[model samples]
Target: MGPGEVAAILFGGFALLIILRVPVAFALALAVTPVFFIEPRLTPLLLMREMFKSYNAFVLLAVPFFLLAANLMNGAGITDRLIRLSQALVGHLPGGLGHVNVVVSMLFAGISGSSTADAAGIGSLLIPQMKKEGYDTSFSVAITACSSVMGVVIPPSILMVVWGGLMSVSIGGLFLAGVIPGLLIAGSQMLTVYIYAKRRNYPVSVRSNLRELISAVTGASLALVTPLIIIGGIVGGFFTPTEASVVAVLYSLVLGVLLYRTVPIRRLPSILYDSARFAAISLFCIGTASAFGWCLAYFKIPAALVSQIEMLGLGLIGTGIMVALAFLIIGMFIDAIPAIIILGTVLMPVTEHVGMNPIHFAIIGVVSLSFGLITPPYGLCLLIAASIGKIRLVDTLKDVLVLLVPMLLVLLAIILLPSVILFLPRLFMPQFVG
Candidate 1:
């Protein structure tokens, strides 16, 4: 069969599996079946070989280590200390604990780099507290879900590592690219919360005196140092991004076990087991999605896509906006990792054709996909937060929409002013820029 015909069956079959509620890994594997049977020189065994090769890269090792590190930190007393610190810093704002939730997620995002992990770790702690403080359940879930998206946009982000590894962009540069945009999103979310708090007369948290603020900062200092260790090590050439993940794990272990003594020895086994399970699921999707991407490359689908995009006569900014919209739509349906694996390679050529920087292209894609963590049909972060609060996803949509407006605006700004994404990368790592 021809490439177009095979592409149809592969994607159409995959869509059917999605409708059937099959896991993304298995669905991707199953989607390749028709290609093997139709192509004259291929076999099902090639699919297995592709899957195996995907996980062989050393850089990919960072995924599991980062996951383990986040799990360890969450099990320790880090979340409590960070929460107290956020309360001391911003809890006096109009939104009170609502503002606390945003600041804490921003801090935790620097550590975990996984939105689901942020939601699972921080949401589990604060959702109930927000409820007890008379905040609406839907609003609580909305803010937690909205703010958790920063986990993927900030430095130490697992999503950036995966995109960098796959696309051959500098992981350190991608880390630099994400910093300003992530902070902008966090700041906007806090402002949104403040407006809502004023309108609803949400209670303000008691302002922390100097002693209390110092104590909270002192307690959280060890936890706050994690992002510095990872980012500084990578940017300083002290370690590669892969090696930085190991450093993160070691630092978390020392902080949790030796310093705080909160993560007991008994909890180690369960934590390792759970981290392994989550990592397995994530890595498996990466493998399957890589195989799926291999099929696209083998058939030259991306070139075909480039031709189509070129015919649209879009300039760089227009092309960027189009790509951002496409990723946002895709993210709403699938997890970000698999989306990055399957689509990142396919779309790189499109961006390159228009004189866009690879790092800028990557940041645009990463920021757009970050919203998928909260958008419906998939919305993993939103589901996690809602489940923690015992509320429905639909109930949070109104508030979520209110929050997404500024996020979308920030995305537009990134597209229109590429310097917003490229400035820090060029300043700190000029060699990485195109």
Candidate 2:
């Protein structure tokens, strides 16, 4: 079959399965099944081989370890400490708890690298408090869902790990490049909170005094060092990305068990089980998605796409916007990991053809995909937040869209000004950016 036919069968099948409400991982695998029979040289065994090859990477190990670290942090009461610190620092702002939700997600993002964990842990705690404080349930759920996406944009991101491993981008450079964009997203969310607070007359806490700020800082200082240790270790050449994830897991164990003593020793098993369960889900998606991606490559679909896009004569900024828009749409339908495998691969050639830096392209993809976490149909983070808030998903739509405007602007800024994403990576890791 021709590339067009293969593309049709692959994508059409996947879309049909998705519409049937099949799980994405299974749908991805199932989508490629007919292709094996139609293509003369392909077989069912190729699927297993490709899936195994995808899993047989050292860097992919980071996905589970980072997830475990996030779970452990939650189990250890570390999130509570960060919440307290956020309350002290931003609670005096208009929509005080809203600000706290954004701040804590930023801080937790540095450590957890899993937005779902941030939405679950932070949402479970703050959504109730925001409601109790007389904030609108939809607004509380929306802010929590929107801000939690920073978990994948900031350092130690699991998506970056997967992207780096699959696409051969520098994990450290991606991590460094992410810092500014992540902060920009958080700042925009805070500004949104301010506007919401003013219009709604949301409560603001008394401004924290010097001693209170210091105490809050001191209380969460150890947790705050997590990003530094993970990012520094990788960029400083002390560890590979895989090793850094292991280190994060060990550090979280230390804090939970020995340092903070918040996590009981007996609770370890359940934490391990939960982490494994979540990891299995994500890793399974990678396996099936990788197989599906292999079919795309086998059909030379990406090369065809690159040639077609080149015909348009789009420049760097134009191509960047196109890339973001594609990921944004696909991400709304699929999990980010699979979206990265499927869409990121297709677009890599397009970006490279335009001379866009890989790290810049990566940040655009990551940031854009992060939106899926909060958008409809497949907005995992929003669903989690809505579940916690006990509100209808549709109720949060207006507020979520309002919060997303600022984030979309930040994404556009990175696309228009490479410096927004490139400066930190260039300053700190010049070798990788080049």
Candidate 3:
């Protein structure tokens, strides 16, 4: 077979491996093995060199530290405090319980940077209340799952960070770009919840007493600072995102261990151990994807694909539309992290050649990928919320469709108009160009 055919088979095999639930790292390495032997110019040493070189960047340093911070915040009861804070602020509106679920998801997105974490954290707190408040179990669970996508779209998103490193886009710009869209999604969800609440008459407590409101603010102020600290640390030039992750860990530790005093020092080891495991998965998949992309390049997949597309005359807008559609579809099936790793590596060159902004593309990519976390079937958040609400996936998936429409429109606007993302980054930090 030609090298391209060999590469095609390898890619097919890789997809099969993923479907079979074989780990992505194994799938990636296996996909690349053919190139190692077939192309003598690309030796086994080349693959290893690629892996080592790929991971050698200082930016990659932030990945593990950010994952660690997420783990610690989860373990230290930081997530719960933040949930309560979101609830206090938004829990009394019609469909207030649903709003609480989403608002909390967006807030937690900043801290956890993982949609799964968002689902797990906010689902545990909000789902029961939603059920008790007379929301349909399926609808409630679906809404919870849907809202968790905000984690990746909001700043400090792990997916964005990965894309930033891969595409050489501005991480800060990506963060800023996500700010308006994230709020838009949260607002959309809130609006949807309001409509649902009014239509169905879901239970809502009377707006909280002023004393409770005041008390809620007093108690939750510390937790609210988590995002502020993250944004300021990165935006103010005090640290890079990875550096900010370390700062986050230290900050969460200080608040949880010293000030709030929830995360016991003795329990730190377990937190580290848990975090290490998740981080290992992230790094391994990343290294493996790098290897797989190397293998693809060895066979000239991007160049071949780009040539074919360029011939087809699908200009930037057409390509963007098609790519956006594909991403939204795949986002429903795959988790954001590895999806970004695979697609970003392959499509980045094409995007750049078309004169697209890498930062804008990353924001679009992450947000587009986020749909997969909440959609039916393979969505990780769907399952998480289902488990919490004890709702069948089939029953909840329908309602999720209603919310998906508006979300897609918002994504389209961002894709067509690059300014939504680039504006804030330019306004605030002109110097931090990717």
Tens digit of per-residue lDDT, candidate 3, span 344-417: 77677777767777777677778888887777556888888898888778888789988877788788888787
Instruction: Give the candidate number with the greatest lDDT.
Output: 2
The regions of model 1 sitting more than 4 angstroms off are none
Listed in order, each prediction's TM-score against the native is 0.98, 0.99, 0.94
Candidate ordering by TM-score (highest first)? 2, 1, 3
Error of 3 at 63 (Å): 1.9
lDDT of 1 by residue, 222-273 (tens): 8999999999899889999999999999999998899999999999999999
lDDT of 3 at 156: 85
**For each candidate, how many residue pairs have backbone atoms clashing (under 3 Å)?**
0, 0, 3
lDDT of each: 0.92, 0.95, 0.78
**Model 2, C-alpha of 58: deviation from truth (Å):** 0.4
State the lDDT of candidate 2 residue by residue for 96-133, as single tens digits.
99999999999999999999999999999999999999
